[model samples]
Target: MPRDTPYLQVADEIRARVLAGEWAVGDKLPSRARFAEEYGVGQSVAQRAMERLIIEGILEGRAGSGTYVRKARERRRMIRSRIHREGGGSPFRSALKDQGSAGTWECNSRARIPATEDIAARLAIEPGDFCVMTHYEFLADGQPAQLATSWEPMAITGGTDVLLPEMGPRGKIGVVARMRSIGVEISTAIEMPRPARATREQANFLGISVGDLVTQLERIYFDSEGRPVETADIIVPDIRWEIAYEIEVDDSRF
Candidate 1:
């Protein structure tokens, strides 16, 4: 039988200790010298073992602070549905309310920005077309929870009271209500979700480590004529929220 490498052996022992509740979450780990002495290995070996656990998310290293066991991640539930749109309330706020947390959001809107190819494709408009772009940062209980960048074609909303998503009479109401006010009756919305690693920008906004797990939802709203009215890319951190879909069953069809 082959023997395990020194670092692997030490790592396994430490993991076992953690699982056995030798140290509670957020407990600072022993110094490298102490671990080396306890494991009968070189200090380098002990360091390697700790580094491996850090990457695995069992531990975290704080600058200017000692290494500590990472706290268990809190998972909040987020439900996506047409009901939320029809309700005319912020979906993030609604989800947080369901979790007993107060949700608030800050938004900034920029108009006359040229749409990128991807945004153009999603909005079904030509590249370089003018669009009103809005960036939103949503917080739950004073903690960053989600980020969203939404775009609407100027051809659809320009010279209207709803040109800016967060201004005017229908401002901050919601996409469905705002579009309806402009004589565009939204009939359908499509969402495509994909798992991805957090970028540095996203990590900064969500107060998480870079490369953390995130879900990117590409959402598009369409009118009765199948014209794309608005599109948004919403970012949800996996450590903070669990994405759920609420689909209605069609008993009539059955």
Candidate 2:
């Protein structure tokens, strides 16, 4: 069996203390030098142990202040459903409605941008194909809650009033409605979600620490003809939201 390193040993000891109620939630942890002297380890070792705990969500570091035991996060439920897509309008609007909070958003739309290989694959278009991309920052009750970047093939909306997602007659209406206005009937949407670490930019946008866990969702919408019409990548901070999928069971199964 592999033996525990000095830092791991120190981390385990500290974790035990926390679980034993030696330090309550929001209590400041000992400084690096103090921990080192207590554990008979180097200051670097003690610091590394604390960093591990921070990444594990057991502690948090405040700039210009010391590290403290992290409080339990209050997570709101984020439900994804066809009902929401049809009735709730935007994802941010739906999430806020579920939380009983008001939603506000900022968006920027870029038209006729060339799609990269990955985005082209998702849209089922050739690489370098022109696309309309919109970036969004969403807040609920004045707190940053979600970030999304949506891409649509220009082939579908080119020369249409809905080409720019945030402007024109059907602007800001949403994917299903906007496409319907353009004579396209959206029939299905597919979403895949996975856990990931937040990047520095994402952390800054979501107001969380870098390396904090987040939920990344890849969603694609298709028309009746099975052609990919739109796709988006959404980021939700794990500490702030818990995702729920509302899947309807087919009656024929019974």
Candidate 3:
């Protein structure tokens, strides 16, 4: 509409530079005037590109200074809604495996009150169901990376250790991996990304400020027969994690 026909293309050029390590994080980007001149384009085009990148959390703009590349952090390379798409495995485990070395988790389950509407729906057992809730605080390199809570219907996993009141999984094994040993193949998963404010407990668990930006991922796991099995909600510090998607463009016709 504004003759900035390919604004996303222009932004991709800058994003490639950032991702390639040519321009490190926190480095000041070229001024708008300079970029416009370099690309032989109007200032509006360059401005649009910068604005889009800022909105995508790739860059930051300061009032007195200039646009700066955001400090690169441990980025998430995978987020699959379906378990079999990304190598046919548990999406959450795949996501964590790619970001960094998997750290030990303290896993435990308890009979918890269904406090939120979302939880009630995910468990699919009614509003006040005695839910079997699993808690895990995952770490990477001995530092906290994320905290996750999973809820399941007590009717399905009622008498199992899924509702044990222990401190954690004493053996420190991933729940998904544990499920597989019991011949329950996790066949479906759904992930939702949301911007959330950190709670006091989440802040302490994540080692971040109470007001820091956080991206929360809610994943629902289902069995091969399409029955709901588990629902996991993961909290990741915004500054510490990123999600990337790569699409191939074929120009064979051209």
Point to the candidate with the largest lDDT. Answer: 2
> Which pairs clash in the backbone of model 2?
none
What stretches of model 2 exceed 4 Å from their correct place? 1-20, 23-71, 84-87
Higher-TM-score candidate of 2 and 3: 2
| 1-254 per-residue lDDT for model 2 (tens digits) | 23267877888898889888899999998899999999899999999889867755688999989999997556788877776444777666776677688888899999989999999999999999999999999888988888999999999999999999888877766788889988999999999999998899998888766677899999999999999999999999998788898788889998
lDDT of the candidates, in the order given: 0.86, 0.87, 0.68
Writing each residue's lDDT as its tens digit, candidate 1 over 1-254 gives 13267887898899889878998998999988999999899999999889867755688888888789997555768888766544636666666677688989899999999999999998888999999999999888898889999999999999999999988878877888888888999999999999998899998898765676899999999999999999999999897688988888889998
In the range 1-254, model 3's lDDT, one tens digit per residue, is 12235655677788888898887888899998887887777889889888867855688999999999996543544443333343424344555566565545666766755636777777565777777677888776677778888777766655555344233352234445445555667665667789898888988787665566788888777778877777878888776666543334569966
Candidate 2 at residue 206, lDDT?
86
For every model shown, the clashing-pair count is: 0, 0, 1
| Order of quality (lDDT) | 2, 1, 3
| lDDT for residue 200 in candidate 3, whole number 0-100 | 88
Clashing pairs in 1: none
List RMSD in Å for every model shown. Answer: 5.9, 4.9, 11.4
